[model samples]
Target: MMNNFSLLLLSLVTVTGVSATWPSDWGFGGWGFGAWAGRLSPSQERQDEVHDVEILKAVVTSMAEWERSRRDTTRVKRADGSVCYSNVGCFMGSAPFSYLGVLPAPPAEVGTSFHFFSPREPHRARSLSFEEIVVPAADALQDAVVVGPEFVPLQQDQPQQQSVRGRRDNAASDDRSTTTTSSDVAKSTTPSSTISSSSSTEQVVPSSDGSISLTASSLDGSGLLEAALNLGFNASLPTKVIVHGFGSKCSLIWVHEMKSALMAVEDCNVICVDWEPGASLPNYVKAAANTRLVGKQVALLLRKLRTQYGLDPRNVHLIGFSLGAHVAGFAGAETPGLSRITGLDPAGPLFEAQEAEARLDASDAGFVDVIHSNGANLIMGGLGSRQPMGDVDFYPNGGAEQKGCSNLLLGAVSDISFLWSSSEDDLRSLCNHRRAYKFFTDSVSPRCPFPAFPCESYEQFLEGECFNCGSQRQCGNMGYYSDRSPARGPLYLITRDNEPFCAHQFFLRVENTPSPAEPLATHGRFEVILASKELNESFVLTDKDDEVMETGDSLYRLVVAHPLMEELTSAQLVYTAYSGWISSGLSSWTVDKISVTDAFGKSMSFCKKGMILSSGVPLLVPLFPGDCNPPRAPGGLDIAMGPSISINNELPSNASGEELSASNVNRTASPAPERPTENRNKTGIDINISLHLVTTAPTSV
Candidate 1:
């Protein structure tokens, strides 16, 4: 008579097509599935126990080492050995329960360089030694739901396992012919892992408590339709499918944060795609390949939703991060009329330089927007693509080095601060890749608009040459509400280093010389003050430490809040030069022209286009001199503008540059001493300044 144990082994071997017998000296050779039969010899059992114990110890030790190195205050080691540190989940267990749960290993042809989770059947009897059990590689496991104290992918190798996985595979291939025939592009189903019994796709519907529910196990078209209706998914509302990146689960903090923000704005159906079965860690290449299969499954789900309900394909939006970004692109390619797709710093390592069909591109949807926050070298751990992959690509803060990620001192403080809520990966790092999604989440319902200006490059943006938005170079907003429908090409913007990443933007053009003569070089800081009917504001502008400017015509942009003004009044600017670094090595500054603009789309020309104003004694020159009056342009020290000014020889040249000194240049003396006889050889320098308005009112407000 066939007993339950024998029957179970036979059933496993039959379903997975894996033989029941494997070498007992598995550790000495390599890992493989084997039959569990009669009791083992005492020596053999002892060896198995020792090997299992050592593996468990190694896993646990690695987890501890990682946690200690991170030193994140939020880290907590659960009783079950799982560690939730740095907001990234880490599952650890003894002998059978591995970090990511049991998953079928990749094919033997791919080499045995991969490490896998403990077992797919974690709920099996613990008394039965792992050596006495049949365990398949991760690529062979199937099923999508198995709720328990700790969550892991479902087990589908059993005889009673449903055919959902098989149907999902077929749906991926079948829907392609019906959906993508018009483009004449062959629809290739995403390559799935051969080890698993089925695919690694799961469907999530937003629940009433602002949480999401795993409603569907497989990608079966019919099953998806049933689950969609049961979950109260409204097909009338715009559908947003949020896909996660490699080694990430659907319940990640950023994923939930995005879901909450999206649902709060409107009554829409937010379907978060959960494919953790293929998104496991320690094997990034496997996860990369799984994106395609998972993406096809998503297309299948969308197709079912459209056919079963009166859903419009044009209203669907796909947003993906890292590898998930490419997944979204694949989905867009399969389904053709997706309204929009947003790539949050799409992964660059393997996807870069790949063909259009192999990665995200503008053709993937009606309007595609991408945010590149970490586009540095691969050797530096940068994971974002540098190539423009969307209709509107934003390179905030130059799109390579991010703000707030550095601050060696702050990082040390945060390591001790129990309230460390930000991801540890972002702390004390300049180019953290995850900021793409963080910026997007805040922009969904931000207090201030994240305005992006169309610029030639990040370098030009810093120089403030690309602010004019009308005919020359049109600008646009970035993030969820960006006007990508009409916006084209890569856009550049700047952001603050802390929370509330938005910053006020202004573009200024400085005319440094009036003639073609050799331009003067000067180093100093300047401040702009505005007087209006309602408010008074001041902004300071300075070159970066390494940004020395040679006297010449130049355009620059400033990101700072300006005083609110319905109508133009008057503006004034004050420039103080560093004692030893001024043009001609003199203690004075020369100005030729000036222009001004505010964040509220207001523009005002300070002086006549080519007018020259010099200061022997540093004094404020009213830009809109005619507009300065009683209630219109309020209080400011009136200083006369002239082509030249005289300075006193008695006053020392080492005056503090922090403020303009009234005594050094003799403000009361109309004409004092002439330039030093030796200094007469140097010519005066001219500076032109223009401010271009950049920020726009938030769409929601």
Candidate 2:
């Protein structure tokens, strides 16, 4: 009977013009079966129902053939006769045969049941019971089974039963016990698996869509807080919940790093939300749709915490990355008075132009701060939204291309491979997109304050036009301490390419003096190289256009340096002239003086009248006291050298100046020290000024 039914379905598929291979045009509401299902007449719909039944029968009789038929795609090959493995291509290729069903029933499994429903009427499902039917390994692709637990709608007036499963932790206790509720009967029949917490016997069961497991950590050093279901959550401490994005699990290294940083800074409860089952790979659209359900699950968890442990919603902070950001938004929306939600580059594809309720927005929490690291358009290979979705949106380095992500184009292509595998190495392609969380994590225990200024655009901020904190002190911090600022709009800042991205910002001004011997306007840019005891870094002071610097003109720029140098032993100037049609031999310019102001408002000026700067040559000038005179006072009298700005000062107590490498820099948050007012000798200050350009490799954490 099954063989005949399978043959009949095959004949009908041919008559209906259904290709033997998976259809490429199928999607959530795209063409193919869904479009045809909507237009079918009553009689045709009945025929479709028959086809569905026959397909189920085929599942029982010819399971191997069913799997093989989906793989057979000779009829759907492209013009080049090659299979398309792109996300859309692979998704559409396998979506048609995908079904919502269960594994075949085992013999004598009396209580085993499965849900059956047409794709067109997923919500109108019915359960089927089978006895003594031996099912083979037919669903090779795992497409027939639902990704998570089946959603059982609550019946009116019926109590909702929830089952909690626990395991025995060998180290914590020797008690071997199992607890079960009425809902265990339903859980036993489902295909969901269990994930055990590392420090406790608590088992997180993700049986249905939106289901999540939470692992709690606190500052007591016990590692786990024991509570209802052994969740071990402390109600007195502030709670921070971290949610991972698509294709990521809660066990990610960055998540743990952030958790450690949060705990090191304050005594709080850190919870990592594990939603890997619903956010699995190969079907991004499905994962995207699952976020709504996962968000509701998170809201449910929060409510449980509040009821069981008295955790205040206002004391809870949600930090989510990519799609998880929107998930946090949904959870925050459901649980009113959420204290804060920090979105680390929210996913852009389906949520870019979505309404406030659909994505992370200001109304989701009391304060919504977002860091946009890759905000370019989707077609242009940007995974993050460019739109401002939070109350205080920060666009670091313009928020599209990061300084160290040179293989952005290659990374975009590699992102497509995520449809198959979710390897950590694949993250190298998403360097810019992942930087949002890295920046946030670093800000938790920063070496220096990650200050960002209010600005209309990054261009205006880099020009040093928006350095002031304004009358309201509207400047904001970039990461963990963002709420300290009163700013309520977009903020801009610059960051380094590697670890310890936070830097001390300085506003530099170079004044050109008119030299009668060589006074022709020069089309060139000046590069300022700052030298200290530990490191030497260079930055361009002029725009990329190489704007002609006329005599007596002053150029201003905003530059950043890490491992905050307190005093400078020497400064080097490199001038590069743009090659033009006309040639001028050995072009030189005269600089009257150079001035620098640190973030603390301390200013210093180095005077060297008639200092000649030649193109393509490095000019070193002494910055120590007695080697160069200070800027003259307004009345031409020499200014007293009281509390002059110093560079190349001593390293912090935690850092070793001689052995400090980029990787070993201490990043623990600390207050900036007061500048030294004591005078220093000009001699014995070893200044190494090598024009070595440093490039940092892209890293995941």
Candidate 3:
């Protein structure tokens, strides 16, 4: 005479072998399974409620628009150069395909190609240098589909959503193996607290003339992060992805399971994360160089998540497998607001060779966990068979007992997991280290990994091997292993959240004022910029503008292709002031003129947020990873700080309005006075962002 609840619990214990002590820090101290089972604090409670509310708000749509943002190659030539074979349906038999549509023409091979939506700007597609490449045999190709909302990675999503406030036991692991259902999660740990402020110490990603979109935020964090998520949710999807990570050389079976898991979730946005090599088409580069460059790129991407996209820093997490683990961990370390770091048996030599700051560890990353697959780690020796994989000293599982196929022929997206259950078999699951990752605290299900073993409480799960040592497929072996693949939905791409720092790298607040007739309400943070610079001989500025620049006119322009480009509401003249002018301190009101035809030039209204931008008061912030010499925090922001003008004698004009009259700004008296004995230019304007924000009203077209 057993009841449904008892029977269900019995099933859970029998199938998963979980302990009674589940859901530790999730505020559910040994409580049963239920949304309201946990006893969370006000903050935790509020966060939980907010997530649930968002879960309700999210509605799915076709993300066909976003697909255009990335380059797609339906087919590529095989090295054997035989036929144009496609990777469609079940693995088509391997036929030597010489050419594919995914790659561009020969011109694209030599010329640098630029991506409008990318913050990386003016990128040369990995390289289309047109040479011999890994020939794809028809059988080698696999049908690729984007995962929908159901596939978002919670381990990494927590940070993007601002929830990585404790040990970052991100359930990130390189566990995809022979089985279709197997997948692994990395365990991470961290103290409880969210980090939203940007650091003044970190260097901004240098501004680029190439098409680059930036993401910047401040105070409590808001901006593109919110907009993008909203946009993602609005797209054709069942759900919007909050975050995701990337791995390498995964199996087809793994991909199937991952898609299934994602399909299980409703209205979820899947944020797909991959390495540089996964840039649509395959272009090989030196493993060492690619690794380092990927790290920097990851940091820059984080800036975009914050300033351009509006993702909160504390919600950011890292999930990677093999070399991907190195990339994710290194990038997380470089980012200022990172919360969690999960290493799925990080490529040993590739990661371990670096200094502690650059490696994935508790000390370096606020929260970090590692899942050794016996697949590869220093414990055994030598980098995984995959190219660019590091030496064994770094990853412990360098030798025998490894399971994952050691082929360097898979996309990072292929490694997502379907069933994120607790079972540390082969040391892949149930390992004490793996069990404690930050995500474990949020046990969605109440039972522990060793349910069948009959552990009465959580303390036993922790103290005994039963809790930390069960695998999805195997009950014994110690290598990390994934028992299931992530179910489908959207392509879960995980980027960082909003960060106050690195505005230069990405767009922050913009003050776009198009036409005086347009209400200030139409003015928003993200507006297309129009420069008034008269294009002349070398695309440089000329004193007169009677003639438009010719095809050869040296008009080197920068375009931001990001959807969040409209967030830059505060506009500033981007010009190098004339050095010989009598108005030494004041820069001419010059800029790259934009036209109404611009994508962002359309009329749009927006709301302004309060910023401590000029708080000029400095505060202590964490240093980015690889801090050979971390920058010191300022005691306070110095609001009194002003731009460096050529002339120290006369103060610039301080105007109350957002703009200066064209007549006043269009002065041609540049040659009138010399620097030493020039006019008494005392118009007195202090170029302090703080003052301008308070005094000037919002402007827009």
Candidate 4:
């Protein structure tokens, strides 16, 4: 009876519109049988249902055949006109799979369950190492069968349903007894046979004309290649792979900012890897573990891209942060000879103590540069690694505590701040950890250059010993435009605490001449003011408590972090003595010589001609007499002593005898002529003479 019914149905389908030959475009959404058959069996409902089910089954079979055909087309013929399947191919399409460079996964038995907890919240999950979190996830990825959209957890689901907080408390104890077996670890390390044939989990993102969507149930090299081709990614141009850390996603503000910055700088392929499914937050242990697997997947995609498109690996640059930094390292290792790898404070925790194979190391790429913005001890809540992870590791502000993070944390704690807000205070807490990427983005084409002095430590850099980049000492540029030095080690530099952190750094030496009669009398704060056509800047020459400048000539090195980008003109040196038991408050000192050096190591000196300075007044000292055509002194005077300025024998004093006012001092410089075309420096450096005493009081030290 069934055979008779099937034959009748088949005959009806054949007579109606069913073609003997299938259509080439018969894919997942294509069902020409339905379109061709209009109103089939309107009088019989049961027959119609049976016919519909059978037709759907036929459509599924056709779709499978179409996939097979498409895959078969990837196999090209050899010189003999026979299809070839080699382990190593000019293109990886339909090539025989080999486990030449497959990544190792963590070990976990089937049916092992896992739970997660927030790092901020009190939880026993902390007691469980990273191995516990990632091993299970890796095992699931390598072995678990996906029946539908969702991943069937390899471990059995826990019977007791508890709140998030309760689960957090019991996570460690619940799974402590069931230790991972040795054989399970061995099996997990060696991926299952199914893994090599398995597809990756991914989503495609395009720049123009289409919304981002996941095309298939799995991610793999072929899908990635097709997506790149369809999205109009130019294989000839350099490709920048930006990978985000664990617990973060591709849509991060910094990631978008970097993409935009790179695009603005130059046209290139910017592929932002979004492994959110594997690296989801609050499950940080799981995310951390998945990094290796995701990295391997990325490597495979890159390998296919290179083989098929002839995209040079030398043009490939990997930029990753925290856990993603290690991901870049893994990819670089898997695909040898990558052009560059920039790690923005690679994650600490388990990675800190891991071997080179397990964590980011210097040998991953041709040129590996690292920025350590937050390397505070992990136990104290810091998130980045303290150990150097790249060939040239830049430590900004000692790479321990960042400039403003301390204050932000203090404010949050004092105010009982909201958990999530757009407040500046809230944003700054993450500022230090994320500043490495921010600095790099700005450096792509910054207005002001970020000049860094190479020193053994930041302390030495601050002390002014490492001011010169020449004379056997080297200098490194900070951020995206960094020029790696042959002499590699920890490079130190200081930056502003906020955005637009780049500043002009200058090292100046103040030569203080002692009073001939009372040499040991200078004991107070000394202020030096430098003026330019655009801005006025000052530095404290003498410390309030220091007595070193009392007996003889003292050489003080001052590091000026000038926020303004202007050429320096004239300077005024003032000294104020502290009121002591023996020393008078109105005592004076003599300025002999002043020398200044810039980032280029060019030194410029101005002889002060022994100008005596009183506590109540500022002593104006001329820098370049050649540029100072007609000095604008108290009486419109033009006095040039080769390279010196005359000093007033006596100065007017206020009631306190120590409060120096601009009115009390006779200070002036030659007013710059209106756009003197011929007199500008040949080098275009605006080092002209245009100084005037600022009436505003100097900030107290």
Candidate 5:
């Protein structure tokens, strides 16, 4: 049975994505035998039975346009010995809404590709880290069978079942107490497995019209999140972490922007969670209590991520604007899984409350570094209220309000808020996913250049080059001011007045009928400033080169997640075998590192760490070698890499899906489900996975 499943899966690997002519049925809706035949049964009935009430329909809708295009495809050779194909079919949401990465088993030979970006794999930075989170195809990618944490009592189906944290801290107590065991408790509440009873093992049977089907439980109630069909269907791994907003006038700007940034950097899988608005608090006391509760929920999600996905327990980052700041902070403080949180002007209203818990600070949560624009965040112990996972936190100009609502969904435009005020369309505070990303990953936008240096200090920092304002053509620095500095201090950016003055210039909202025919005036101002952590204790842990940065130093270091350098390009830095360097005095450090600061500078030590340098630019992501990054599954057969603006451009809408379809468009492989008669009283859990794979198929065309 396993072999059958593996063979069925192997048929889909168009490793040689040759662009030769294909068959007309390629990527079109088709079927297989056995469970496959049952798949087509009551297609409409399944639709009617599938109960989906997720209010975040826009998320689904956002993905729908792309989903509808997925289709099955097949390869065919012509009479002339060449090959060609065709696309057809439609795509529908598979089963299991949450984190599909672990579901609907695929053959071990295949896995889907997720796009992403990271401090370990930035787009154009100089320094890079070894951060690639990949779950093995099926076998290793087992869905977390969550029961419950010891702290909270889950409302299980069992009327009287209970779970409590045991007082015993000893290993013997942990093993014998049975208090931590969720299996018995969960079984008391719900049935063992949600899968159907008849399925022994998935066996793909061919059907007429050259299509396949499978028998599995799925999201729509029709099937489980089935792993694969021959349809050259495609999947994306969301590499970016998005803080999705849940309130009206509460835009998820940052989520979208971060998505774009991650896409620009590499193929990544995106995890979308709610950024709910705080319901109105009648009083300070109530508000404070509510804030605590909100924080708790955030904490729960963090743990879920850790248990559900192999999200680096340390690398999870949060970027929240407006009210999300509170939520991010609450989650960061409350959850053990979370490491970083970026509060873009966390609302000041909540801080007004008399409640102590409501007053968020670095210490409140485990996050080490803190950042704030205005004095909105409370400062305690010289640490910031706006804690981030790393030791370094940036406070761009505009105080706490600097780009307050950076949750701007628009990609490049999201970067604008940091350098300038936003337009009316985004006036209600948007999320700046790009800048937020830069906070932890040093993923600065090309538009918003880093402050450049010319005094033999830092150069080629991209954008904001050091220039002699004294020289006519050189003084147009976007973030720099007319002032030049030779001191070891903040790097200032100067903005100039506009020519045909933007009628809607920030600080001035001009209406129509302006009679002024006068010369276009300049209205530039200092936008952002970069300073060494040495300037302030919050930014402390600043060290010079050859300082022999040890374990206690902030784990922070500059990195270029991705390199544009086509060939070998190594930064001139020496990293001790036991530790990664904080800075390389050599001018050669050029992998896109904005800077690397530690969360506990001189406080914590790493057991074993090594240096990772970008050896190549690796422009075409998902299929390239990066700073110790494993390659991503390539796009489906016959497709080359393209910067598809529309999701369909990257993935297959049901129609485009047909372009990559196969005989098993609906065929599925059912992992061995523990039988009620056999394992009704099972002991340890048995795990299996169906991995949908995209291989090294080449585009023959």
Candidate 6:
């Protein structure tokens, strides 16, 4: 049965005669069933087979109709007085196809001149010869089919001219027969430049002339509305417009998840913008160029919503991911007083170096918040921009390579098995690039507040230096509530690797105090395990680099605890000495105390004076609270709190000599030290621990 299904897919590809190269990173070994046959159950396999067949049939019919439209001889005059055979011909003469080839001269009666503003040079208008534009018959098959969760075309041995009458007839009889050709649909929706379809199940159609489609769906799963003044739209509610990036459509799983999340959080109008025809794969440069036109369409829609329906522009929030981010920016630029725009890892390739007017910037809206999840250089496999493009930028875990995306093999496997997974987000590939929307969706109705601190750099933030959000730098929420934050500039925070990435953060400081007999500077690592009734998690304060810890040195780390621990019951300390040839004997170190500060400004100190820790041993210590208040001397003078001392022989500056008696000396309670035990549990720490630590004092006071 699996072999027959694979053969059927291959035959369909052969019959369609649509041959094109797919992206190398798509991880397509071959059109064989071996990759997924064993992973999916019988029922899932049957459903996938049926779905694949339907998609292939639709692709064949759509391609056939597009070809017919491309070959049509009827000339239509555009509003700009340019004559073109069809909508596809008009698009062929546009700037996106500039690199294709020159067109032949036209007749004296026909106008062949086509003018379009170049994306690279927006200030200048260039005229191109479009007397008779001819797209290569073989290369004209540019549309990609959705196979499972990925957008890829079927592999074929060679391009062959074959009839698609059977597929077209089958598609016409199906319930999805309303799906029309790209050019046909573009003509029908040209007046408003928006397509109205069911947001729940909109078929992605190829578009030309950079035309945009809008699908307005409410929480009740109502069908698409024609305009903002339609009965389906409620002017009283806030509006959230979601735009997808290049090589993606509005009906994508992530787009659906985001729309659902936003609607679930509040009663709002969710408008999903679909520009797949202009933003399809194989021509990233063309898609980048089309963003400007799509942005204009979105801006026009917002204007109608404001003027016709009395919807305030301040209540409109545009959320765009990747290249779509810039689309929202363009719209925001046109529509003044637009409330906010949230860019999720805006595209980096063409627009990263472009001017602010051409890309997403803070000036585009009243407030712009950007989440940069994969902002590394393009040469390093990053697809998102690293530059700050908003009023408040968020760089979660440095915004480059995200957690749980380090293993290339794992990501590839996830992509291949996407169909079998229960949740599409869990098995999606390009983990870092796609994480921006996931984070934003999770933040809509979060389990806890996703607080991010305004810091100069993520490295400094990890050292517990930027714990306080003050007048200089205010704290910002990572997701839905970021616009309400007073924070300006780049904010940094750490999250878990998986879902519910938000974690309770705490600043932890451990002071190392050694005895006179022991070495002043010991070389080892310290691991702190915080245990609560809800969860037990461990975090390392130092790396395995044989770090030297002097007697007075302190280690600071940002502890991110998940499962929402209300109160920490106890903590376990594990010390491992660096095994060197000269120091092969049993090594030991003494710790004074551990201090923890929560996000709410509450501080707790756990003290056990002269607690000895040996190599390869774990010490389970109970949570013993210690008073951090300064003690008063016998003469009622305050004693300055300093490092813990074994003996206090000095007197207060204003105290008399007679008052310096032993009974009059200030004393503080110290918890009894616990002995190290030889337990070999070797439990691994949670994914929240970043493994980077700061040993020196923070530069900022």
Indicate which candidate wins on lDDT.
6
Model 5 agreement with the true structure over 297-392: per-residue lDDT tens digits: 444434433443434535565555434455465556544434455454444432433233333444433343333333332210010123222233
Q: Put down candidate 6 lDDT per residue, 627-698, tens digits, no spaces.
A: 243233455433333322213635324323332233322233322112112131122222232232334221
CA lDDT of 368 in candidate 3? 52
What value of lDDT does candidate 4 attain over all alpha carbons?
Answer: 0.49
What C-alpha lDDT values do all the predictions have? 0.47, 0.53, 0.25, 0.49, 0.25, 0.53
lDDT of 2 by residue, 1-701 (tens): 54653444343221110112212121112111111222223343232223222221222223333335546754663311101110001011111112211221111221222121222222221222211011111211122222222222111121222212111001211222233222222212111112112233444443243212233322011222231222234676788888887666543445545654565455677666656555655445545555554565566556545654677988999999988898788677666568999999998866787656557888778899999998876544577898999999999988987877654353343234432343333334467777898788767653335778888789998888777553434677888878876667888988877655677787877777654466657787788777666667777888863567877778778887764466655567777676766643337776766666655444545554445777767766544322123233354332222222234443323222232222322222223323221122111221222344534321100
Ranking by TM-score: 4, 6, 2, 1, 5, 3
Residue-wise C-alpha lDDT for candidate 4, range 241-289, written one tens digit per residue: 8887755554333554565445444557766665655554343444555
For every candidate in turn, the CA RMSD to the true structure comes to 21.6, 20.6, 30.5, 22.5, 29.0, 18.4
Q: Could you tell me which 10 consecutive residues in candidate 4 have the lowest summed lDDT? A: 80-89
Q: What clash pairs does model 2 have? A: 149-207, 149-208, 225-232, 226-232, 227-232, 567-646, 567-647, 567-648, 568-647, 568-648
Write model 3 residue lDDT over 1-701, tens digit each, in one string.
22542343233211111111112233222222111223333333222122211111110001121233223533533221111111101111111101111211121122111111111111111111001011122232222322221221222211221112222233322542221111111111111112224332322231242211222221113333333432232223322111111212211112112222222222223232333233111222123224333443444445544554555656554555445565565456545556555454454433444444334544434545444432333222223222212211111112222222232211211222211221112112112111111112211221111011113332342233222112221121111111111111101111111111001111112222222243221100112222221210111123332212221112322222211222222222222222332322122121112211111112111111111111112111111111011111154211111111223522223311122233222222111101111122112211111111212222221
Tally clashing residue pairs in candidate 1.
26
How far is 608's C-alpha from truth in model 6 (Å)? 2.7
Give per-residue lDDT, candidate 4, residue 641.
Answer: 25
Looking at candidate 5, what is the lDDT of residue 601? Answer: 13
Candidate 4 deviant stretches above 4 angstroms: 1-229, 407-428, 483-487, 515-518, 542-566, 574-587, 616-618, 624-693, 697-701
> In model 6, which residue pairs have backbone atoms overlapping below 3 Å?
207-277
Per TM-score, the best of the predicted structures is 4
RMSD of 5: 29.0
Question: What does candidate 1's lDDT look like per residue over 301-409, in tens digits?
Answer: 5655666566787989899988889889877876656799999999875577766766788888888899999886443435578889998898988887687665332
